[model samples]
Target: MNNLKYSICYISFFFLFMLSMVNFMMMIHFIMNNMVIFLEWEIISLNSTMIIMSILLDWMSLLFMMFVFLISSVVIYYSKSYMSSELNLSRFIILVLLFVSSMMLLIISPNIISILLGWDGLGLVSYLLVIYYQNLKSYNAGMLTALSNRIGDVLILMVVSWMLNYGSWNYIFYLEFMKNDWEMKMISSMIILAAMTKSAQIPFSSWLPAAMAAPTPVSALVHSSTLVTAGVYLLNRFNYLLVDTLPLKILLLMSGLTMFMAGISANYEFDLKKIIALSTLSQLGLMMSILSMGLPDLAFFHLLTHAMFKALLFMCAGVIIHLMSDMQDIRFMGGISIYIPLTSLCMNISNMALCGVPFLAGFYSKDLILEMVSFSNLNLMVFFLYYISTGLTMFYTIRLTMYLMVNDFNLISVYNLYDEDYIMLKSMFILLLMSVVSGSFLSWMVFSYPYMIYLPFNLKMMVIYVSLMGGLLGYLISNMMIHSMNKFIQTYNLSSFLSLMWFMPNLSTYGLSYYFLNFGQNLLKIMDMGWSEIYGGYGMMKIVKKYSIFHGVFEMNNLKIYLFSFILWMFFVLLMLMM
Candidate 1:
């Protein structure tokens, strides 16, 4: 009964999910058997809609749903132990259910408005999950991720406004408008920017790693499975419409570069989950690049394989942390194999798949991308940009496995891993099994033989073995040179790379978070130019504080004048927004 907290969470979620699962299958059956129809078309407002339409489920969307459900169920079960010791476990389950519902709705939403609605709710709900810990840093990270995604929300709103201005909120009508109206294309570019930022490509990448402040299961939810995947899911669904856009080109380049940078960053991280966080960022970048390159099914496939394998990996890391007094640093763990054999096996296998090793989930999906990129219409430079990052996945995976479980004599034995609670082990075992099977299931669905990232992954040599071998050899050589006890090692090649990749962004975040200052040039610029500066008052503000003029102006006998002036300004801004 001491574990009743988690029990209730599991049962409530399982029951709720079972109900939703039935609905999901019912939806599939309905969609397969008959056309879904909406009746009564008489909407006269922006927020309300009425139209008769049917959304056909393509293989891509159906596959994404399969991942969506599979991941949600796995995370919930994993959460039972991942959040076992925390308070509000039951409420966490409720929120998890809400998040799942919102994501599923986002996937199946036939209209942009409904998608936006689901997206908005998902933001709020996911923010709630991130800040659930209420640790000060978690609060900040959650707020930042929510805020960046809000920028995306604003972009989406811009698209919505443009659509409304063009006559109606119809997606079909908007696409038709794109064929002729430059404004429609501009609006779509804005939407693509929103999607890119929301998915954390390059400069928008900070928030996701910061999101590591959440509990492991929440991190798994955000990184491995649900909310963040929303962006890729949308892109995959809308790929047909988006392929010809210039933003698709920009996305391809940016997302590919992001993949490279993120994989490099993963090498610098020492925190167990932070490594996974960086890896997830890199993986998302890869998925986005593939989607941008006109491979929606491949992107969806990557998402599926990534979610399963990454969830298992996170759960394995969660186990180590859970058992070891919350010691999350890689420096603290060596010979974890001696303590947690089950966890070590899970981690090893999952990492192999992640590193693109043979017969694992990450292998097939990633191979498809490699094949596409290798054969893409794009030039060699762009193709190799992503390919380089794919190789880095192998590097970082080896680094993780070597640092955590591959060392010599055991140093730490702080907990009885085998005697660990059933709930945790059971939760993990479920994910491990799925991780083992997802690779094969996905291959069958895609009608391709499983190709490994390593030698002899399958009965038939479907993978490009020479490329895989070349990547491995290059990785081994780099590892040796970087770790060798020579002049270069003394100068510290690996540490320098780590500093540049891992510590620089953290430093920049600190540097850029200072109070804004743009006063002297502002008043003239504000009046002469239309761009208003929201910067701090600087010397003027300091002078006001020193002289007490600030209080006097607002609290003096001239307060009514001030109030009237403020009202007039508010009215002016409103006038501009309307314009």
Candidate 2:
């Protein structure tokens, strides 16, 4: 069994890597020639309607596919060792392959129906992955993850129905037309709602952290490239429908709030995985908000770059979690850099990339995003959201770093901590190298011309300034102690509200589920068991019983009734003879 799992992992890794390389070459060729290939196969046609499956091969789709394959390859290779002890490792690798296939389908498809095929595939497979542990927490988290993505799936179905007006499911052709038609706005709105749910934007945001219940490899893949980014990719494809629209405005606000919310929530979180999950949420917000601002290129660029470092970060965290016997709280983790220097080095580099530190992978995209935000004619509220969220990102990154690498050891005495797993280290090294260079490499490849940033000195220095302040604040906050009184205790309500994701999890899970379940209970009682049963079934039975009793009484007087009936029969015979 172990040999089979190993063989499966190696086979998957090799296949995915070769595919990634091929896609990369194809992407470069497409970019150089400025070409797009659209292949459509018609399945059925009735009157004005046609059912056609489509695959769109453009630079964007190819590039995204390349990244997806690259990440999946490394993650699968990494998992060979990471999941070596599990009996069901082969099943896990197969599921991961299924997930990658789903993502690829989503990337290449132009038809809404085909997109939904991949979309639903991703949601279902992710739920299965999330619940792989077969425990209560995993079950609950899987439920949340599945249900959240289900909303997006429903919206996509609605989109498919709405697109029927055009007699085609190839929505790519009709995007420009959708922008002008008020009737078509409904489709766009539904699409945005779908994207929001899949991306875990505000109100639907609670499930991202909950999804950490999945194994670390799953988390690294899902959060970094495949699951959460599906929505962003969808919107990126549908960018034309969102230009200068109300849905775009709403998306902008929601995404900005999402960014801010995730940043603040991460600071208050202590669970290492949850913190990283929140950081993914935060970066997703960045991608979405930038996308909403009408720069799909920047959004796509960030999405690609973010994928590199974010996956590396999760891989590093996985190694630590594995070594620590599945302990995730950062409080119990301190100064393990002394023991696992290589892992620590990777983690710190990834963290710096996350903070958008200069010259790193994150910096290339993030700095450009900030500079663009400054360059655009935007309101103070939008401006504040952009910069403050940037700062909060750095703040959490520093705090997390300090806790893991700077503070003294707080775990049980005599814990084995080493970076000796060559498989895991090799996989991480692939991402670490990408995390260092992919940003600049993608920046040059993706953009035809560099964005000219003509900003004042103060405006140009804004990111740096905010980053410094945030880093200092993180250090101070991490070092500070409450000897006299606990401030969190003093401000219990505020702290709880902030720490609990503004009670979103409660609102999403209990608040909505309780009321709906209660309503359903009432419906079941009143409709199914009460009125329906009584009036439809029980009442009819009672009437039949009462009639039967009345007939029984008549039967009791059968002799007299028979004599009367004989006379009546004779009268009826005489009447028939006269006729």
Candidate 3:
């Protein structure tokens, strides 16, 4: 099959899939036997301590490794057709493999020091991938992504330093001890901060949306499954120490606000990738919030399930973008289903799953998460945020669907519609199946006993009510037209603020850099060009010249100069003796 050469990634995909399957079985066996297998190598030894490279082969790490491999394999196979036109196909595939390897490193390591190796690898490789297009937009997005992730890198390095005090860098062993110590609590706070940045929580969120400048497959892999989830995975690991703490409560507040913010922003978004990016942000906030509520298992459950559907969603978007000549504006897309029905089917399924439609992938995790939030002792603000965010998710999904699937096609010609790309379709089908089945599969595997969420009639129906209202509003908003074309001018400022993510991009970029840049400019002016020139270098030359000129005058063969020099020398000698 020479055709298989074009899809070389499929070979790698199958190989990785087999490895993942094996790991899954091993993990299950370990879980069943109540055992953990750790492999350690003492790389270096200090007095009474060792710098160790350790692999943690337990249910959690193995399970996550299996998922990572599963997703990466599917992504690689998907990329074969997606990037078929590119000249440097091998480079792209290599980057994807490197990314997968780094993710694996991150998954298996229990030591903080070893974890940094993987964490920084992800940041570095993702930066490269984001800039793969070599355009100005991609460059800017790459810088933002790298810098945002670099903050986490620095934090993890600090964590490594903190772990040094315990004479061991293995945080897996120290989480319990660290939970009780005040000093260790500070360390835990840093870890949470690192997680927040990686997860794009609150202030660190500007980069995630900006990173949509990359190719869609990179977005699918990095944003959906790997890079962003690293933070949640880290927090999942540290959930024991974080439970019921003030830091975790802060996480809850920020995460809830982030969820609400991204949801609202997605409604205002027009770009296809950006809307999905915001949706991912919203989902991440949901995961972080659930984890903050002391439900790491629920958070992890949502994390894995979200990875499946969101990746599928991005792949579908990629297919649409390719079909429409790289057009990513939903406003420019309408009635796409009439052309590419299969892709549209996958898109709708993913969208419905995103909205937590009952029995879909999102429902099992999202509904459980929301119900758990309701059962917890939460304030009215958080309560409203959780429900409203859920509604906003549906709002954006319905609005997106209206723009892409229901409205009339806006293209100049109908002949441009060609959807039969079996290569792309095949990869999408793989994820489509997972998006439908992964939720039920994970729910069964992760929980031995079913959770009974007992609520009153009104409370039980809260999610459905919000979801229905959200859908209705989305349809109305998408269809509604203004009496005057300039009607939006009245609310332009408010809309712009919400649409621009509260100017967070500006804040993260120019706002953060303004002072340092200003100070540098001032130093260049006053120190380098002004003061140094006047006093240090040029000024010293001027003083020396003046003294030399005076000395020449004094040494000149003139009677007046000789008398003046003698009088000055006599006066100087008398003054020196008096002193």
Models 1 onward score TM values of 0.78, 0.93, 0.88
lDDT of candidate 2 over 1-579, digit per residue (tens): 678879999999999999999999999999999999999999988897988889999999999999999999999999999998999888899899999999988999999999999999999999999999999999988988888889999999988987888888898988875578875788888989999999999989999999999999999999999999999999999998888899899999999999999998999999999999999999999999999999999999999999999999999999999999889999999998999999999999999999998889999999999999999987999999989999999989999999999999899997999889999999999999999999989999999999889999999999999999888878878887543334653378987888899899999889875687789999999999999888998889999999999888767868888789789999999999999
lDDT for each candidate structure: 0.71, 0.92, 0.89
Q: After superposing candidate 2 on the true structure, give the runs of residues whose Cα lies further than 4 Å from its correct spot.
A: 481-490, 529-575
Write one digit per residue (lDDT tens) for candidate 1, span 1-579: 547776776676576446546655654665456544432244344445333232435455555666666667767877776776667778887887788778866776556676777788888887888898788888888877787688788887777777766555556435543544677667667767887877888667888888788788777767887777888887765565676788888998888888888876676667888889889989999888888888777787788888988888887888788777777878667777877787788889888778777677887777767866655578877866766786677767777777787654333644455536666677677667777778777676655445333333341233344336535544554346545533443356766765355454554355433221234356567754433323345645566676796566667768788889899999999999999
Candidate 1 Cα outliers beyond 4 Å, as residue runs: 1-4, 16-62, 172-180, 408-415, 446-508, 511-579
Better of 2 and 3 by TM-score: 2
Whole-model lDDT, candidate 2?
0.92
User: Higher-lDDT candidate among 2 and 3?
Assistant: 2
Candidate 3: where is the Cα deviation over 4 Å?
A: 1-8, 481-490, 517-579
The residue pairs found clashing in candidate 2 are none
Candidate 3: tens digits of C-alpha lDDT, residues 248-271? 999999999999999989989999
